[model samples]
Target: MTAVLSRGRSDAPVRSVPGRPAPRRRPTVAPTWFLLPALVVYALVVLYPSLAGSVLAFTDRSGFDPGEWVGLANFEKLLRDDAARAALTNTVAVAVVITVVQTTLGLLLALALNSAIRARNLMRTLFFAPMMLSPIIVGLLWQYIYTPGGPLDSTLEGLGLGFLTRSWLGSDGALWAIVASIIWHHVGIVMAIYLAGLQSIPPELTEAAQVDGAGAVRRFWYVTRPLLGQSTTIVIALTLTASFKLFDQMFVMTGGGPGVSTQTLSLVMYQQAFVYGEYGYGTAIALVLTMIVAAVVFVQLSITRRGEHQV
Candidate 1:
């Protein structure tokens, strides 16, 4: 009887307690398999072309011929190329300026608007309106504004500042003009990101800082900015990458002219591949650009992550 009772107890079904449900096993494999179709499409559309282009970087294909492989020759030429070097310098300058200015201004705008104020919503919308416009449209608009006798010059002249006006898109100032337009066009997005981060921060933090006799600046330095590390990381990474690859607005506004003063790596790559039929060289430039962006972003993220951990 004792052996039979022990056997019966061992074979008894487990039951959930009253008012509770049994735990269900999650189908992890099934959920992962569901991602296969999208992954397949991404591989075909993005990865394949990228890999093919990278391979072509070693060959002398000119879009018309099955050209021979000339490993590292194009890269060697790139090292000696003056225009490529100049474009690289300009690209770095533009990226750094845009990243620094955009991030700072965005944070300022977010802080200003985060406070209770009249028509804050409307002001936010107005500030972000430029981000909604296409790059081409913004380019055209700024192009018109920067035209010698267009609104900008006319306004300056009308304000007795005619001496301040010059060839906005034709002189040394052309690069700066392009940089300014890009900043205006994309700063709104930066503002929006910072604003979201600001909103997500708890009000209790600020109030506690105030109770501890912290002033506005101190509160921001200690309470707000630290909490915004993730947002800053995201914003800086995005602006840095986008600024490096900037092509459309610059193309439309200056065509990298009066010379190569405003030319960036992307513009150079485009001109080489499609305009000059140097496909191999173009791909090589593209590969260099990809590597630079990846390396910079990786370093930036690592630094930001380390800072977050320290905080």
Candidate 2:
């Protein structure tokens, strides 16, 4: 009987009586209110406008009252419009060219500036100074240089290269001229990014590679380049996004062109919305542009991330 009682006690689950006090509840966590203001502002300013604009893309709303539903007419018009097609192609081409050239030139400049030269600091300052200037200022400055009798023309003429002195911003050479301006204005930012990345690399790694009989090129290929993965990723992503959304320079410089040679998507959107009063079409273009920018950024990040994983 004692054994049976012992066994029962051992196997029995403990149960609280009905009058027993409930276990103390954990203190309720107060949600952080620090992000509230910024979140609210973002929702109001950015998110709401984006959503509203997307909705507007489907309507034939003017500045007047009573907007009518247009369905896919605006998009269909855009597809059939030769001017729109040309503008899109030009935008893509210019963006790609500028991004490639800027990235290369900036990386080269960063490498040069990283050398042990007495004038390195001065050179770095000069190189990065253009980035400090406003886009309008950059545009005006380039416009002057591209004028028929500007410094560039004079310099080329003086060097007996008169053939190279054609009107830089005129129809024949305007596209290349705009691209050149973009590269000049933005390369400094890229250089700074590369410089930062270079600074972050450990000197010991390079030294060790050198000590092991690796040549400069080999060491760079095996060490420096690999280490710069993060920086390259950042540069590419920023440059890609900036290139796709290029606007300010175009606005101030060519105003969509001598002949539509430099009419980017943003320029087109502006013309549609403000110039032609085609608000619906303009909003559709804006939405597509946003999607394109997102896609480019995503692809760049994905490629860089995969490379990083391999490293």
Model 1 C-alpha lDDT per residue in residues 1-311, reported as the tens digit of each score: 11211233534544545556653443448778999999999999999999987998899999798689999998998899999999999999999999999999999999999899989999899989999999999999999999999999999999999999999999998999988998888888899999998888889989999999999999999888888898899999999999889999889999999889999999999999999999999999999999999999999999886645222
lDDT of 1 at 104: 95
| TM values, all candidates | 0.90, 0.88
Please tell me which predicted candidate would have the highest TM-score against the true structure.
Answer: 1
Q: In model 1, which range of ten residues has the least summed lDDT?
A: 1-10
Error of 2 at 152 (Å): 0.7
| Superposed model 1: Cα runs more than 4 Å off | 1-27, 309-311
Best by lDDT: 1
- TM-score quality measure for candidate 2: 0.88
